[model samples]
Target: MATVTESAPSQAGTEKYIPFETSVNYEKVAVGGAFENGRLESSWYKYASYLPHNVPGKQPPLEEFQHQDVGLRADPEKKALLNAPGAVFDEITPAIGTEVHNLQLSSLTSQQRDELALLAAERGVVVFKGQDFADIGKDRQREFGAHFGPLHVHQMGGQVKGYPELLPVYRDFTAGAVDNEIKNNVSSIKWHSDMSYEM
Candidate 1:
């Protein structure tokens, strides 16, 4: 269970406290609340909300999924990608969300991409500002995700016109068909793992 200390008053009135080392973003905690089993559980909704009850559809067999190679690495000479001076990160919280600045997602080399992944792993979620990923196109985006393993095609949501592997996350100005997805039980505001429904 979480180590709760003395209660304190905030806008939420007196609330239990946990160590910052074990805390997560307040927004997520506010939305999903948290459980204790030693540490605060702030990211459980990501996977738990995507179960068959939440998202309808049979997933592709595990055998069809691409497995991650334990020995993946970029070219040894590509050291510049590891320490690109153009990129900047501002942590939104001590536990989650880092806004990345000036890093060109399209221009990163394989080794650089590995470094980017490491940064994301270190900082829960990494946000890139003002990136024109549309111009970068579906193929490149798929290739970038493929660096880790096979890219997951979303079971729900809009895919690019020709790219089934690419999901369009940007809000288009036009109103399109509303997806019949489970929403009352699932929150877009909550944090979840990508395709957590899949094993």
Candidate 2:
């Protein structure tokens, strides 16, 4: 279950107590549109307005999706990918992310691609910056993506005219007809503190 700690007032009520951790000192926000953004001071159980009426999730047959995980299967490939002459790695956390430097994704050997997959699966999120991916053009970009696996067509979000895999996240114009017009509102929102990466 999610947990929270105690909080003290700011300098205005400084005489009461001083804070050791700034993250615990959260101010309550009471406004019109800030409901979801604001962090309310409450226990995980009491904060949400509802309790589960049914069990959380169910298992499904995995024959279609089953495959040897790259992290486990490509152990030897990770060495060649990381130990290249100029390649460098900075693990973001002890657990989650990694930043790989001095390695160009565009010029990877076939084995290095498998190593990349391994690194990604093991690290959870691998970040690479200063890439030539943008200048390579749409065809090259699509080809590179296809090298990983079958391209995922986004069910929602704007796509390029010919390329269905590229989901344009940054949009200034009005949303299309399939946007959150049907059931996406405050009423339909699940406010409970479940493990949600989607939110």
Among all windows of 10 consecutive residues in model 2, the one with the lowest summed lDDT is 17-26
Candidate 1, residue 155: lDDT: 74
Name the lDDT value of residue 39 in candidate 2: 42
Clashing pairs in 1: 1-38, 46-192
lDDT of prediction 2: 0.53
Q: How much lDDT does each candidate structure score?
A: 0.53, 0.53
Off by over 4 Å in 1: 1-60, 64-66, 69-82, 170-198
Q: For residues 93-156, write the lDDT of model 1, one tens digit per residue.
A: 5566667688888887767777666666555676776777646655777887788777666777
- Candidate of highest TM-score: 1
- Candidate 2's residue-wise lDDT over 128-182, tens digit each? 7777765666677788777676666544444555666665433111222223543
> TM-scores of all models?
0.52, 0.50
- Please list the residue runs of candidate 2 whose C-alpha ends up more than 4 Å from where it truly belongs after superposition: 1-73, 171-199
